[model samples]
Target: MNIIEDLRARDLINQMTDDEGLENHLNESRVTLYCGFDPTADSLHIGHLLPILMLKRFQEAGHRPIALVGGGTGLIGDPSGRNEERQLNEENVVQEWVKNIEDQLSRFIDFTDDQKGAKVVNNYDWLSKMSIIDLLRDVGKHFSVNYMLAKDSVESRIENGISYTEFTYMLLQSLDFLRLNQEEDVSLQIGGSDQWGNITAGLELIRRTSQEGEEVKAYGLTVPLITKADGSKFGKTAGGAIWLDEKKTSPYEFYQFWVNADDRDVVKFLKSFTFLPLEEIDELAKEVEERPEQRVAQRRLAEEMTKMVHGEEALNQAQRITHALFNGDIKELTKEEVEVGFKDVPTFELEESEKGLIDLLVEANISSSKRQAREDISNGAIYINDERQQDLKYFIDENDRIDDAFTIIRRGKKKYFLIKHV
Candidate 1:
């Protein structure tokens, strides 16, 4: 199938300009397209997955994809999706965020010199060089204040007050597309549905700024905003944002995020994110309907997505950790495995000379007090290194260490604690 057809079938195309014409243009040759990602955080959340996946689809379909890192725009913050003005980050902080985001994006798109391979560009390279006077005379004049104010991005923030810096955000974004169209021959811009206004503004800029009848055609496409079936936002848990970086989000937690996908949203998520062919997806859909308790589809989704972002080794470690934790087989795990497995769990450091099991448990917050810790130990609710430790006076001394440095403590059935020798 053609690119547009594939996108539509997968429900990736939320809004687009002239679908037929864009498809015809795309099928002709290796047409260049771009999607801009602003570094709002050090790592991308699952909400950013749709556009990145869309870019992957474009590259697979023989179109060149340019992943634009909005180093310049990130400092200003795009107000498209926010209810109020965003807190602007510092230049140095945004630059660091840009580097982190670029490194993460590189994992997904091929950046080789092949005809349709992806490329990365930073708008700061161009946007930073433009003088204020030149910017106003060359690009700012094309967009009137009335037109800018009418945009939903600005309109929604009227009561809260939008700044001039933010007000010019659309113009800066438009210039990125105009520049890419001129320099890289990029003809399409893709983003989340919230970016529809900014994407269209870029298209309009390209239309008006290009030479007369030059046929510098460009298109805009957006993916639907990911939301929970129960009407909550995606990519968020009670803990916080689900980051692509392993340091920011443990692989186990990331896997759990997908494994816990609502029964209603799993089918749509599979189509939107995974490259599994339609037939295989259809079969999985049937399996989901017939036996959701098996959770075959959910497992596949979690595995595919986790592997894509975190790599095979991390996925394996995550799965192993999950199984080990669930089965109460903590002793079976190696020191390295314990480290990776309990990376997200609460931890405490104890000097071998200073503390025993009771003091350690209370300090780690596993119990309210030393007396409570003693009571739990007597009640058989405490396990050390996967063995029941029922003695209150059983101090974790040097011999109790696994690998001579660490101790694992479990309270009840679900809570875990790690103690390290200083």
Candidate 2:
């Protein structure tokens, strides 16, 4: 299938300008397309996954993909889809964030000199050098105040107030497109659905800024904003944003994120995020309907996506830990496994002298009070290393240790704790 047809089959094309013409451009030869990512956080979250996947799709389909880091535009945040003005970050902070994001992005796309390989660009190079007078005369003149105010970005914040810096965001973004179009001959800009206004603004800037009657046509495409079927935000846990960085979010946590995807969103997510053929996805959808209890589709989705982002070793480790935890077999777990597997689970340390089973349970915050700890122990509700510990007077010692350094404490059937030797 062609690039546009593949995108259409996967339902990745949310909105686009002139689909027929864009397809024509794609079929003719190497069409250069660009997508911009703001350094709003140290690492890109699942929200950024759609566009990155789309760019990968473009590259696989023999098109050049330019991943633009918004070092300049991040200084003045994009108001699109935001409820409030962004807390402006310092220059150094944004720069560091940009570097981190670039590193993370490299794992997803090929950056080598081969044909159709992706290349990273920073807008700060061009945007930072322009003078205020030159910006006003060259680019700002094409965009009128009336046109800018009519945009949903500016209109939504009218009552509360939008700053001039934010008001000028579109012009800056449009200038990025103009620069790319001129320097790299890029003709298409892709982004999330929220960026439709900004993408179109860039397309218009390209049309107006070029020579009269120039055929340098530009196009805009956006993918749908990912949302949970239950009306909650995607890629968020109680702990906070699921960062791409392994340190911030462990591979197991990232795998669980996809594993927990709602039934309604599974197929759509597979389409948008995975490179599995359309027929295969359709087959998986059928399997989901036939036997969701097996969760074959969900497992495959989690495996493929986690492998893509985190790598093969991480995926294997995540799967191994997942199976071991599900079976209540803690013996197979190693120290590194324990750290990443139970990273989010509440933890508390106990001194070797305070290693009594009841005291450890109470101190680990497993039970609210010592009375409850004793009650639970008496009722055979507590366990050590997955073995029932009914004796209230049982004291944790070196014998109960998993590797001569740690004890796995379980309160009731679900809550788990780790007691480590100092």
Candidate No. with top TM-score? 2
Please, what are the lDDT tens digits per residue for candidate 1 over residues 154-221? Answer: 88888989888898999999999999989888989999998899998898898888888787689998
Scored against the true structure, residue 174 in model 1 reaches a CA lDDT of: 94
Return the TM-score for each candidate structure. 0.92, 0.96
List candidate 1 stretches off by more than 4 Å.
114-116, 353-375, 391-400
Provide the global lDDT of candidate 1 against the true structure. 0.87
Model 2 stretches astray by more than 4 angstroms: 114-117, 368-371
Q: Which residue pairs come into collision in candidate 2?
A: none
Candidate 2 lDDT over residue span 1-422, tens digit each: 89998888887889989988999999998989999999999999888988998889898888899999999999999999986898899999999999998998899888878544669999988888989999999988998899888888888988899899898999999999999999888999999998888988888888897788778779999998787899988888888888889888889999998888788889988988999888899999998899888777888899999999999999999998898788878777887887777776676665674467777777778777889998998888888888898888888887776656667777777887877766
